[model samples]
Target: RVGEGVRGKVAVREGNGGRVLMMLATWPTEVSGDVVQSVDTLLAGVRPLPEPSVAVRATPRAPEPEPGDPR
Candidate 1:
C-alpha cells in the first residue's frame, strides 16, 4: 500500500507470510517529483545524501525496479 499525507508518505510492504516493511518519506515544500526521485535513489541503495548546496536542477535519476520484480 502507498499513501501520501499532508507532508509525509508511506509505502507498506509485506512478505514471508507475516513480515512487514514500511517506507516513509517527508519533504517540506519540495516538488513531488523531486521527492519521488529521492525515494527512488534510496530504494536503489544509493546512500549518499546530497550536499545542502545542490540545486533541484540537477539531473534526476532513472527509477529502479522494485525488489524481486521481473522488470
Candidate 2:
C-alpha cells in the first residue's frame, strides 16, 4: 500500500490458486511522468497488484447554471 512518504513490498496470493509477487514503491509528487512511465515499462512483465483492480468511477452531480446566464 502507498502512504505519504514510504515504499515497500508485500506478497499476495490470488483466489485462483496463483501467487503474485510485487514490489510496492511510492514516489514523490514532484516526480515526472516520464520517470513513472519508465518504471511501469520496466515492470510490465511482472504480475501487478492482483487483489484489487484499479477503477475510476464518475459520480453524477447536480448541474450548475452557467455564469451570467439564466437557468
Candidate 3:
C-alpha cells in the first residue's frame, strides 16, 4: 500500500537474463477524482512517434567555381 488513500499489490519475478518483471495485476484502491485527473493530465496524449527517415549518399558533389572564374 502506497498511502492511506491508495492501496496496491505488485508481484515481481525473475525473468531471463536475471531481469525483473513486475505485474500490478490487482490494485483495487479508493482514490479521489482529483487524483485520477492529475494522473491523466500527467500522461495526456502520450504516444510513440514514427521513426525518422535516413538519407543515403552514393557519390560526392562536384566542386563549385571560384568567385572570379568562369563556369
Candidate 4:
C-alpha cells in the first residue's frame, strides 16, 4: 500500500526529549527484513595501524679517511 496514489498517515508524538517521526507502510515481504536489519554496518569495517618505522640515514661516513692516505 505504498505506491502511486497510495495515501499515508502521520501523527506527532512526544519522544524522550523531542518529537519523533514515524512512518508506517506495507512493504514487500523481502524488503521489510532487509530494512529492519539496520544500515550502521552497511559498509566494510576498518582499524588503525602502527606508524611506519623510520631510521636516520646518514652518508656512508665519507669512506672513513683511508688508513694511509696522505693528509
TM-score of each: 0.36, 0.37, 0.31, 0.22
- Residue range 1-71, candidate 4, lDDT tens digits: 45664433333334433545443433344454455343222211222333344443343445567789875
Order of candidate numbers by TM-score, starting with the best: 2, 1, 3, 4
Residue 24, candidate 1: C-alpha displacement in angstroms:
1.3
- Could you tally the backbone clashes for each prediction? 0, 0, 0, 0
- Cα lDDT of candidate 2 equals 0.54
- Candidate 3 lDDT at 30 equals 71
Better of 1 and 4 by lDDT: 1
On the 0 to 100 scale, the lDDT of residue 63 in model 2 is 90
The residue-by-residue lDDT of candidate 1 on 1-71, one tens digit each, is 23353365566655343655666766665467777677767755523344344567578887899999887
Over 1-71, each residue of candidate 2 has an lDDT whose tens digit, in order, gives 36675433343433333654555545665677776676666555455444443343355577998899787
- Candidate 2 minimal-lDDT segment of 10 residues: 8-17
TM-score of model 2 relative to the true fold? 0.37
Model 4 alpha-carbon drift over 4 Å, by segment: 1-4, 24-71
Report the Cα lDDT for candidate 1. 0.60
Candidate 4: minimum summed lDDT over ten consecutive residues — where? 39-48
Error of 4 at 29 (Å): 20
What value of lDDT does candidate 4 attain over all alpha carbons? Answer: 0.40
